[model samples]
Target: MMSLAYFNGNIIGIDDPVIPIDERGHQFGDGVYEVIRFYQGKPFMLKEHLDRLFMSAKAIKLEIGKEQEELEALMLELAGKSGLADADLYVQVTRGVAPRNHLFPKCPASLSITVKPARELSHQVRSEGVHIVLLPDERWQNCYIKSLNLLPNVLAKQEAFEQGCFESVLVRDGMITEGSSTNVFIVKEGKVQTRPLSRYILAGITRLAVKEITGEQGIPFIERAFRPEELLEADEVFLTSTTSEVLAVTAADGRQIGDGQPGPVTRRLYECFQQKIKAM
Candidate 1:
């Protein structure tokens, strides 16, 4: 039941003030991050998560100063040290500490990591399902990159919370993009449809898991864009992320979805996802 943190090469308290004010990640949001979940002390899809982390760092033109295997080993070592069987491991790579400037600094990159207990959704919420709010997607065009620039997402999530909703479904150009922190999916006629991978939406690992489950289960999985109206009209809707895996959305903007309950298709997918975890 302990939370651990690692800054640079030293393990420290989770709330340690080791980062300097001139750090680019603190000053300019110049960094990329990843959150990997451990189930029963085993990391799920760790290679895929690391691949995306490197991709995000390259997209930001920030050298991580460590090989992929090296970073992976470090993360595993830190998680083991935390002694938590189920945990959320957050890894952040920044452009390093330097004088205040808009230009890149000639310094080594900074690495920060934290391992905390997993934040599992309550059984009541998962069984009963959750509600969401539709909002305009105001983020930059590079939503594919897992960068530290999350002010727009934070604002949208806060707005949803104020409206007594669990999440915010964002729309861009009249088509539903994604949630502030999850991938959106709609089920119609027993087929699952989600927005395709693009610069406008992130390629979520949990979303990929759902795709694999649908394939193995012989369920139709479509990667195509749909409008808000389509989502409203969908027989069922759900969201996926590292934390909220295969969560059902029972209502949107106070409107009931699919008899206002978690649908059969969603439950099937979620059960398959849990089996995937068990086999991991």
Candidate 2:
């Protein structure tokens, strides 16, 4: 089975010339997106992802015309066609095509759903842990919305990529907010902490799942911002996203994080998260 995509309600090969140049998403970065991960064949936390998608659309005043069920059906159809054991549904909705303008486009919305195989996280990183860098958060204030405007994140991640790192933790005003493309968490004094849901961070789906796990397993959890300096002081640090899932950060900016290994808390959380996936 080949990779497939749903463009404007029609399922087609991902390589097809379906998207227009003037699409608001392409021209002005006026769109919202979500990535749904499927383990085996079942999409993990699909409902939660879709709910966030709706919330993101509302944040940007973009109307996705299709009903929720209709959009879900479309994604299901494309995922079924892809036939990958582990894959991601890269779904986006834009303000349709229009002439160049800074204002909102007065047209229906456009949607694109692409299914691609999910690349497994590197074994070295998963088993031991990965190193990351802390970068100043230069993005807009609306990081809560998963919009297509990702130049800042792209640049930051690219810097990490060049530095031979797995990801970049973004700090704003001396506080650790999140990663360039993921939500960050740290274990300090045996307590799990991540920045609270705010305009400063993206509220990753996997992050919410981890939060639920911390509660179900009675792990100490706190939803408050922590300082960048505190990251090095953490006992363990991990990142979460649709693609990265739960990834440990053993170092940042060449400084060892938490004894230079995936600490007990991160490992246990990952194990419980795996069991949660199986139950799903």
Candidate 3:
């Protein structure tokens, strides 16, 4: 089925949605974006996603053209019109269109909203877990902002794919920062540890939810910078994202991660995450 998108102020076919060629987002990547998931026709953690979106825009000095409540209502309306009970809702706000220049455009900003079916991980990958590869972190310092500039992430992900891996676990200096497009976590002696929110990584909404879920389940959770050596010694490793949700990492750079299987702790959290979605 044809997908739908809300461009500027009009809801139209995804392929036909229009944006000015001089839009700052297109020219300078001066925009912030958020990806939210929907289940049973309702957006999951809608408020949290919106909060992050606003934060990202503020960090980059980009203005949201509309009110938060209005944007939320519009997203839900578009999601409903897309006819997908479970979907990925994407929202992007750019500095708008103006004459070609490096300066912020004087025109009002443009907003784009698109709702597409959520693609869950393959059953085999979910059951057997994924294989990851480590790569040097080549991104800019301000990784906290969810900006449209994704060339570094694209390169890392492409390298992983070329090497027959599902994702790239990024390493900076000697510590694990995050994945190319997701947050990284590890299990050690029954405790869950992930990188603390910093300029080195994006503060993932799913990562935060995972922390809360683990806490509610009485699982130990820690936020700290983990060395690459620590990942090798970890009982289990996984990734979290708006679309990927929770995915176990069974291998890294062809090295088996804890018997080369999805560890019990990961399975437990995966089950809990599924339940949370159903409840949502």
Query: lDDT (CA) for every model shown?
Result: 0.96, 0.91, 0.90
1-280 in candidate 2: lDDT tens per residue?
6788888868887889987888889998999999999898899988999999999999888999988888998888889888887898899999999988999878999999999988787788799899999999999999999999999999999999999998999989999999999999999988999999999998799999999999999999999989988888888999998888788999989999978989999999999989998998
Q: For residue 36, give model 3's deviation from the true position in Å.
A: 0.8
Clashing pairs in 2: none
Spell out the clash pairs found in candidate 3: none
Q: Candidate 3: TM-score?
A: 0.98
For model 3, residues 1-280, the per-residue Cα lDDT tens digits are 3368988889988888387788788898889999999888888899989998999899988789788999999998899889998888899999888988987767888899888888877899888999999999999999998999999999999999999999999989889999999999999988999999999999898898899899899999999999988898789999999888999999898888998889988889889998998887
Location of the lowest summed lDDT over 10 successive residues in candidate 3: 1-10
Model 1 backbone overlap count:
0
Whichever of 1 and 2 has more lDDT, that candidate is 1
TM-score of each: 0.99, 0.98, 0.98
* Residue 38 CA displacement from its true place in model 2, Å: 0.6
- Candidate 1 pairs with clashing backbones: none
